[model samples]
Target: MGARNKLKELRLPKRSEIERFVKQRPTCGMEMLSFLNCLKANQFQDSACVRERMALEECVREHQSSTGSGSGRKRKDTLMYHLKRLYYLQRR
Candidate 1:
């Protein structure tokens, strides 16, 4: 059984059951993903990508947190990914 199924089988308390959730519904998420991608694509070749990615990252984080997902079901850090690229570029 999956982890959630196992949790259910154990008859855990409501707070202890560990419900899984996402920042946004599938359609909303797809829309946001596409929009973010568009923002990152065809940048100015310098700070544009990083700057836009950071803004997108903050929006995603704020949306997810406002949904009460908290630390759970949070998506991967795309902002960090952009920051890493910027760091490498600066280092070169």
Candidate 2:
């Protein structure tokens, strides 16, 4: 059986739950995106927000690098593409 099947059999949380967990963990995706959106809308003038955004981006970069599959560069590119789209949609 595939990894997904195994995970299902084990009653593991689905991908959405995992993503939600990742987002909710302190200093993670939701926080970063919130900070970025605030910055883009000129809601805050704090330089710390920029730093937070950069840190989040770095986390995502490292995650993509570490978990990337065959032809790592391709995986990274695909992840970036999806992330970019998600970020833009969140801003809207």
Candidate 3:
């Protein structure tokens, strides 16, 4: 009712605004792929792929710190970020 109407009235970001925040390739893509490959090669035995898993974790941490995403906020490149933002806006 009223809440739905208010939500519908809220202005959404333009396509260009969202596009700039979108990442063509995820951060640490290579490290992630390497980890997945190792897991597959090891027959999905996590114990046998500790090194690859560690490498991927390190890559993700480095990327998060470099991009200032270590603060626990959702990355703007993710759809979840926009959705949550919109939800909050509607609540306000």
Candidate 4:
């Protein structure tokens, strides 16, 4: 491999893009993207990529099997709901 290629670093996709994708589909693949993105943001260079990638994969698997957080859905009990309730206080 060329020296440049070896030196060439990998980066996570943009947060906005990742969020959009994850919102659409919160698959292991999507979580993988997020994990990698986080690794890059934390300044994890290529040397640690293999290790980090493995961790990413593990995280993806865990996320796929579980709904821990960040479900990417509009919450039902938002401020709008509360505001409406306040504006139209019904007699008990």
lDDT scores of the candidates, listed in order: 0.53, 0.60, 0.80, 0.56
Better structure of 1 and 4 per TM-score = 1
lDDT of 2 by residue, 1-92 (tens): 47545544543344566566555354366757776786877767757477677777777776666666324554323544565555554444
Residue 13 C-alpha lDDT in model 1 = 27
Q: Taking the tens digit of each residue's C-alpha lDDT, what string does model 1 give over 9-76?
A: 54322322323322335534654565567655755353545655666667777777866577676455
Worst 10 residues of 2 by lDDT: 69-78
Q: After superposition, how far is residue 88 of candidate 1 from its true place, in Å?
A: 62
Q: Which candidate number maximizes lDDT?
A: 3
Off by over 4 Å in 2: 1-28, 37-48, 69-92
My TM-score estimates for the predictions, one after another, are 0.30, 0.33, 0.51, 0.27
Predict model 4's lDDT versus the native.
Answer: 0.56
Q: Ten consecutive residues with minimal summed lDDT in candidate 3?
A: 72-81
Arrange candidates, best TM-score first: 3, 2, 1, 4
Candidate 1, clashing residue pairs?
Answer: none
Residue 89, model 3: Cα distance from true site in angstroms: 36
Of the candidates shown, which would achieve the greatest TM-score relative to the real structure?
A: 3
Which residue pairs show backbone clashes in model 2?
A: none
Q: List model 4 lDDT by residue over 1-92, tens digit each.
A: 56544334433445466556545454566557755776688796755567657777787656644653456543343544554454344211
